[model samples]
Target: MPVLRPLPTQGAGRLADRYGRVATDLRLSLTDRCNLRCTYCMPAEGLDWMPSAQLLSDEEVVRLVRVGVERLGITTVRLTGGEPLLRRNLEGLVAALAGLEPRPVLALTTNGIGLAGRAEGLAAAGLDRINISLDTLEDDTFARLTRRRRLADVLAGVRAARSAGLNPVKINTVLMRGVNDHEAVSLLEWAMAEGVQLRFIEQMPLDAQHAWQRQTMVAAAEIWARLDARHPLVEDPADALARGSAPAELFRVAGTTHTVGIIAAVSKPFCGSCDRVRLTADGQIRTCLFSRSETDLRSALRSGVEDAELAGIWIAAITGKQAGHGIDDPSFLQPDRPMSAIGG
Candidate 1:
């Protein structure tokens, strides 16, 4: 594991409160546009795209990231969106982030439509890693899930990413019960063969258009049991940084050295170690992916607040971070914003 140098205590201490968690991983949505509309992520009626004017400028995003790194101990920056690669000049942003002092580890999450063409450029421009969303291996099922008949394109993108040397390229698959659940083992087989780390995610309740039933959720333990029956498994050492921020629990296959991960966010909520913060393309700061609340950072940035002053606003926001999202509550309403709008 790489050692993360402790950030300067002056500005960093301002963000720490009752929760020992300091905002280290910043997920920034570059755009709300996507080429494919997955059934679980967007409304069947389509999405209302945010206006270009409302989106934060690339320079503004860079400035905010600098402040985040300086004051919030943000060391890893993940570029996300309806599909981050959809944004123009994405490489420019990657370059800017790469030039940051201490140079945060920059990564991206994409639907993999445009990545085939841009993967090399992005890697050359300093993107350290990538996570591609792939729901099913069956072409027809993928088409049904994404409402796009371009499964070949997505697969090409994945291969392109691997060729570009994106370390440990992660494939995120949402394990929808009765839908792609039957393909779980096959997906793992494909991942092991391709040298990609496969992550099976429990269907989250954030999809506004989909009627999420708790009964449809495949718990982590159940998935483990099924997978272990075919191939004995062992847990990997717990990753402190990714513990709660990410939903995945990692495991290594007994015979093969390849690893698999399961993200049971709904069945097993890892909220105690949550240390991530999300910034929408429009500049709203979201403390949690399932959060209904947001702080308007666009107004603050446009108001010409200095970095230090803006840092204070971020500190205040982190201080009020909820311990965990109560997704099981009957009152738990899907966020008005979709995953595309929320940056994955």
Candidate 2:
């Protein structure tokens, strides 16, 4: 297992891995429960839910965030969920995290069905960024993919998010071959018109049933080809790599202020450049999305592990970090947990 050094002071500095990659961003999953059942993400019916007792309480989550920011130098914290907004007292959690001494950059990723009602409250709670997952522009396609007929609600949440000053709100679209690949540019166009940014992610092998196949993924090259034909894309002039280990490679439309991004996760893995770590809702630490194993932190937390010891466990998870996610390797294995269970 990966092991990390303890904080020098209360909130002193950077934490690096065995390969010298410093982890500065943390993705924290609040719950494994979600309202929608996206075909690519989870099952449609009779999904197994994590027992309430397994989930991190608001206090435990806040304490972990304290250690992350105060000790591990985690400057960014993105709250995720099967659908984060589904978690009650979410604003309270946001407020607690934002109130940390060295306040981290707090953001959220949600399906947006519940956002219209809570965007303002969350922003007021100090959420600086927001990303909404909207796969297709067509209402029918949205229903078919997510098995939820609530696209209008998601769209309204987008408007509410923008109005609430979640500047440059992002829309995450998972591109799939023969499914929504044909609508890549249209999604971009729609985002531009909606006054939000667009990020297209090539589908990966994080589904619940191990149903994913390499041939089924919509490669970033194809999405880029289609988008370039429509809007003429050029690499962002401002340093792309300088933005730390963000997965998206940004692009600018030829003559417009509008921008688009492609997270070529599978076709172009950024594992070598990955600088983020994950803390699952049930309190397991995963070094990478496709990590073969997880270190159980909830057990240690309940066992009365000290803050420094908990922080050490956090660092240990990094020691096992592979150079890459190994999607190209002949022996690569999809994570046993689906995106919903893993944190999306």
Candidate 3:
């Protein structure tokens, strides 16, 4: 166990880092367990998940989020998971987070397996928006991409989210080189028709197998070329600028109000304006998605530290946030934990 760093007695404002970026968006992982074994994320057999005892209980999660929102300056809270729907009491958890004194804009990133049954309840429980992962539209391709044949379930979940008024039902699609790369335009067409936002994310180096290669990963330029050839996308500079710290670069679907986004994490590198921080399911603070070090808070929380002290620790952690994810550096090393363990 690493020793806890000394807390700063002052600076009780936002979660600002050394690079002058203030983090207001918090991505908290409810569980490090997922139903699918996506080829880009983890092995088909899945990973050795964290023990239930090591996982944060519902009460602990609520307390930490409350400290973040009330004490720190977290305005947006996105609940993530190996698959958040696996967390049995997710609706109740959403309700608790929603009931905070200064309620956050609660959102969820899910695989959408069992979401059809619970979308309405989640919406009622104060979930503001949702981002579902749908890499391919073809069932066979989806099965090959994500070692499961539940593409229909994901589609159902997307529709359910829309029906339940989860506005801006964003779809997060990771385009691999030869696999599912051809579906980029088709996916966008589906998203536009479904009245949802679509974002094509550049595949990063977070896969469990460590098999990712720059040559093999689909580039942002290639994605744009494919889409532009079909729909003629125009840069929505105003909308992109308005998003502020959002990673996605917004573009208008030429001559239409509908828009599409591309998160060129590897190609464009948005580290200069990153405003997000991640909290692992086991109560560790990850300043960056590719951070190798994690500050343990579960121990401090269980040790009965005051909320202020916890806030101090959180601030200290962010103070050491990296300038970039460092995927391009010669010294860049993939974190030991894969996306499944680290949370999307």
The candidate that wins on TM-score is: 3
The sequence of per-residue lDDT tens digits that candidate 3 reaches over residues 1-344 is 12233344435567988767789999999888988989888888988989999999999999999999998999999999889999978999999999997999999999999999999999999999999988999999999988889999999999999999999899999998778999999998998899999999999999899988888889899999999999999986678669787888888999888888998999888888888999999999999999999999999999999999999899999999877887878888999899877877
Give the TM-score of each candidate.
0.93, 0.95, 0.96
lDDT of 3: 0.90
- Residue-pair clashes, model 3: 0
Query: 1-344, model 2: which lDDT tens digit per residue?
Result: 12343333332245566676778888899988888989988888937989999999999999988998888888999999888997879999999999997999998999999799899999999999999999998889889898989999999999999999998899999987777888887898888888899999889998897899988788889889999997899886584746457889899888988889899988887776678889999999988889879999899999998999998888777766777788888999999888987886
For candidate 3, the per-residue lDDT at 28 reads 92
Number of backbone-clashing residue pairs for each candidate, in the order shown = 0, 4, 0
Name model 3 segments beyond 4 Å from true: 1-11
Candidate 1 lDDT for residue 75? 88
C-alpha displacement of 204 in model 3, angstroms?
Answer: 0.6
Regions of candidate 2 where Cα sits further than 4 Å from its true position:
1-14, 239-241
Clashing pairs in 2: 2-316, 2-319, 3-316, 4-315
Give the range where candidate 2 is weakest over 10 consecutive residues by summed lDDT: 1-10
* Candidate 1 residue-wise lDDT, 137-190, digit = tens: 999998889888989998999999999999799999888777888887888889
**C-alpha lDDT score of every prediction, in listed order:** 0.84, 0.86, 0.90
Best model number under lDDT: 3
